[model samples]
Target: MQKNILFLVTGMTPQIITETLYALAVDSENSDKWVPTEIHVLTTAKGKIQIRSRLFNDGIFEQFLKDFHLLNMRFDDSTVHVISHQGKELEDLKTLDDNELAANETCRLIKLFTEDDNSKLHVSIAGGRKTMGFYAGYALSLYGRAQDSMSHVLVSEEFEFASNFYYPTPYEHYVGKYNSQERLNAQHAKVFLANIPFVRLRHALPDTHPLKMDGYQFSDVVEQINQSNQNLSLEIDFTHKYIRVNRGEQVNIPPRELAMLMWFADNKVKGKSGIKAPTGKAKGENSVAENQIIEELTADYLKHYDDLKGSETSIVVNKEFFDSTKSKLKKHLEKKLGVELAARILPKQNGRSMPFYLPIESEYITIKDNFKDRLVSIQ
Candidate 1:
């Protein structure tokens, strides 16, 4: 059974888009396992033009047919069907009933993907604007599972994506200079899975089991450009030149990022046939993070939640009372305060004892809530 992946690509960024395609087209590991097919793009008239231009600009058209040498892997550009929302995209589903429309869209996307010979595995791997990614994944989840079609999502480069970044029509931050090779230049990342949408499809047929894929991240993506000897005119650099790892130079991924890299590199998001992100309570804070602050804090908190939860009271007095207090209300206050605060009064350097507050709190009277929400879990 040959796994034919269907990529749902979007956006006008030539370099990033095509570079992602190259990784899949010419994957080094599991070469025989996952084979990507044509792209099913959903965009406006302008975006449709962008796709046409990408074919010529990024050299993706040639790479797929010639460079990667999937001799039989033919791309019928005419089949690059456009599912216009009529100025109304995915989010606009509020206007239409999703239940009926998803059923309709599934048929439509399948029609776009169907070929003359047979029905190819439609793995969704498109990294366009946020909404593009969202809708692409959403539609795939509906169709891929509904009709037993394959669905996937590419894990875009790790960056701080703002929650409200997905804005209204005419998306912002689109760098439109129309350079084809640009897709080859975009940074590569992993693709995650569709838990909710997939659940819908999986629950439909008990016998039909869907495959899940993870990601693979190569540190030296530019080096991939070097290996292919392809040029995109984009300046690629790294502050941490060394990955602290001696080997795994394919993408220069350090040991820390191996798991994440494998998930995306494996085309798990091309419509869910490979490794993917962990989606459950098991995904501690660090599960969804980069070399960022939140993951770090989440780590700390998870480890020290208990230690930080119990409040402590710090108190100090002259050395004279140290002995009496050590035996006196010390344990009494601890029980009364209901915290870990202990008294540690001592003498001052000037031959006198100085009074100090407890180690943590004044007197634990009421139960305090947990600390504020931080990226790390304070132990």
Candidate 2:
């Protein structure tokens, strides 16, 4: 069964929750109504109290459900999450730290819900502090799938912030001071649900990304996304036999694997196409073209290896060595840089018997100038 989740963030005003629910499931203006199977809320300690008193004690939530004939919906104290920092529930977002905590909590809840493929999340950002709302929307943008949505509920101006109004009631209910009060019909009030559009970046973040982990702060998520968006650059450090990705983290690559990587990088820089894998000559059945390719690749690989080792070595580059080196380099790169990034620098075969070349463009790849000079001098 598909679970539709309605997630909301509220401050002192708990009315927004009911107002949003009314807009989602009861409003005549909403042609495509989405009745939530479950509802979850994120709020401050004070806001939780307000929700308990007005929505539960006052029986307003149950009234709304009964009035609309909604059934099988889940909502209780367990679903109402209070924003906390360092194990302390925030009474209110008084300081910048409190605001950041709220943002983190919002992200944590959104991430948790989005992880469940069976659940469809509908996020409401109409009631909380502006920063909380922004975080809610932004978090959804980061993690939301196709089944997820975000929106703000719009209430009629007179009832927008009215303490007496929760949702437009089904019957003729009037709420105001007895004297000097303007008579208004609850049923006639308008509540419009404005759907928000956001750029979904969930696909951009792989499962291995830090944003997928719990307790990743909002700023950390933003930083990760920013890094992912930036141009990918590969830098090889010949001195250390390691490669740096986007100038971050030194990934130690073996000498032989580094040689293979250098072979591809050198070819990419020289605007040459990829080299084909050597076809093992069983019973001396090697083709002339295969032998030529193996000889050419072996010479290049030996040049890089000798420079890296700072001496001439008797390492033979046959079919087995080439295949093993390529496989190990691919697996190592994938482990260190992740599959998406590894794909860019890894040599990829187009098809059977086709040349394998680095997928990343030449401009983004750089061999250290000093190392290049040394390799050139040795050559």
Candidate 3:
């Protein structure tokens, strides 16, 4: 963390606390990068048992989390460090500047509580009860890099679904905690889904690896770290290096297919096999017409689409295009060039749809029958 500002926050909501704790837990156990140096949890006199997303008693939350994690374990490494706040520091600070008192007290705690070590990362995960996400993120902004930057994992809503289900009950948000199946389903889908997995911690646990996730992964994290000019000597050993360009780099490139192939080659992920399709008029040659319905539309973006923040139309189109393009592109890159570009898509606008209406294409993450034969050159 570059900011390295030391401070614990008070008066946080229970939801923030829960989410913040989960965020810290992800890399805390056997992580290769991005670990917090020290953390202190604090609650204020004003902030009391405010459990927003609670599925269990506050006393049982910790044990439940540990048990859930163990059950969901894949790679094993048990190490978690979090300290409970004992608000004695705020005893006599009415006379000092609020910000100054916070800073000085934070520093004093760091000095008194921790021994100076070689740890370069420092974070204040405890802050503004309701704004825990913002505070945690802000603290990291002061000193976080992709390799050692600030990150948060939000805790999802769960429930004590009352139904005929098995162990590790599915966690859900019940409209009615105990009654009204129809009303609860209408009010909260979480509760409805959990109804099937009732009486099981399996239902209580959330999905870990989605087909796709919002944050960066092992590969993207490394790339971001390498690219960031963080004023730190961060060295990433990418075995095979190659030149690349973004939309901003005013450079003429080959066809989208070749550019993607070259991208795979540069990234060292293996793209030599190339797209597999019968060439030279072997079979299904006539279907090429359908293969390029949006031929003019090549995949210009494969990384996540930051531009589709609000616009839903472009989001639909971009997603459809990216999925189709990447499905084909990944194959071409892997087989012919040997790498996989970040093959996700963005949203695009449709000229004909009504205002604020997004077009949903049935095809996503699926390639065409005749897509393998498209030939492209990088140079």
Who wins the TM-score comparison? Answer: 2
**What lDDT does the true structure give each of the candidates?**
0.34, 0.82, 0.30
Sort order, lDDT high to low: 2, 1, 3
Error of 3 at 166 (Å): 22
For 189-235, candidate 2 gives per-residue lDDT tens digits of 89989999989978885666566766668876676446556788888
Query: What TM-scores do the predictions have?
Result: 0.34, 0.75, 0.27
* Stretches of candidate 1 exceeding 4 Å from the true structure: 1-5, 14-17, 30-32, 85-107, 111-120, 145-197, 200-379
lDDT of 3 by residue, 150-246 (tens): 3323222332443321112125433443464442331222211110111211123122311112332223322433433222111111112222322
Q: Give model 2 RMSD, 1 decimal.
A: 4.9
Candidate 3, residue 370: CA error in Å?
96
Whole-model lDDT, candidate 3? 0.30
Q: What lDDT is reached at residue 33 by model 3?
A: 26
Give the top-scoring candidate (lDDT). 2
